[model samples]
Target: MKYLVMVQGTQADYEGMRGKPSPGSPAWSEAELAAMYAYMGAISNDLSETGELVDAQGLAEPARTRLVTAGEDGKPVITDGPYSETKELMAGYWVLECESLERVTEIAARVTRCPGPEGITDYPVVIRPILDGAGDI
Candidate 1:
């Protein structure tokens, strides 16, 4: 089975990445940031070696996003983001071929433990099975 794992980020998360310290919040030091990247790279390499990694990518800032909807007259309505009050935005995603949903969930759990701002280890990782062929769909 193939699964998609998504990491969520918020505005505060983006600010932290930009070295902007939130009120009473500690900025991520260069070494910490390096360690975070290293950890992610290591895991990706491991998955690749195991032949489970299908694809992985980190997204650009959500501020660059655009939302399109149908207008009253059937025209397009476009809105630029970074939407205020949004709970979270998709920060990155990984597609992995695993034996089962449990395996994917385990991978997601490990990803959530990857180092982040202020040494936090509680990031959310959403996982969903990928429907491939027409029969699966």
Candidate 2:
């Protein structure tokens, strides 16, 4: 089964990673950020070697996002982003082909264990199975 493992964060979290913390989020030092990147990179490399990694990517900040919705007259309504600073958004994801939910869950748990500051790095790691075919639909 293929699964999407999402790492969630808020705009404040992004700011903190860049060494600019908002009210609730703490700043991440340069070394701390590098460690996180290294840890995640190692996981990706391992999965690539094992042929379990389908894709992995980190999204840009929410400020650069474009929000689209249907207008009242059926036209497309586009809103420039920078939504709520504290709103939770998908920061990155890993698409992995694993044998079972248990396997994916284990991997996700490891991802959550990536190094960070001593406190205030506890966010959710979302996982969902990808429906790939007509039968799955």
Strongest candidate by TM-score: 2
Alpha-carbon lDDT of model 1? 0.82
lDDT (Cα, tens digit) per residue for candidate 2, span 1-137: 99999998887788888888766678999999999999999999999998999999999988888989999999999988788654788999999999999999999999989898765558879999999897997
Clashing residue pairs in all predictions, respectively, total 0, 0
**How well does each candidate superpose onto the true structure, as a TM-score?**
0.88, 0.92
Q: Which 10 consecutive positions of candidate 2 have the poorest summed lDDT?
A: 115-124
lDDT of each: 0.82, 0.89
Candidate 1 lDDT over residue span 1-137, tens digit each: 88989988776666677687764334677887898789888888999999999999988888888999999999999999989878688888889999988888888888878875663425578998899887986
Runs of candidate 1 with Cα error greater than 4 angstroms are 23-26, 119-121, 133-137
Error of 2 at 105 (Å): 0.6
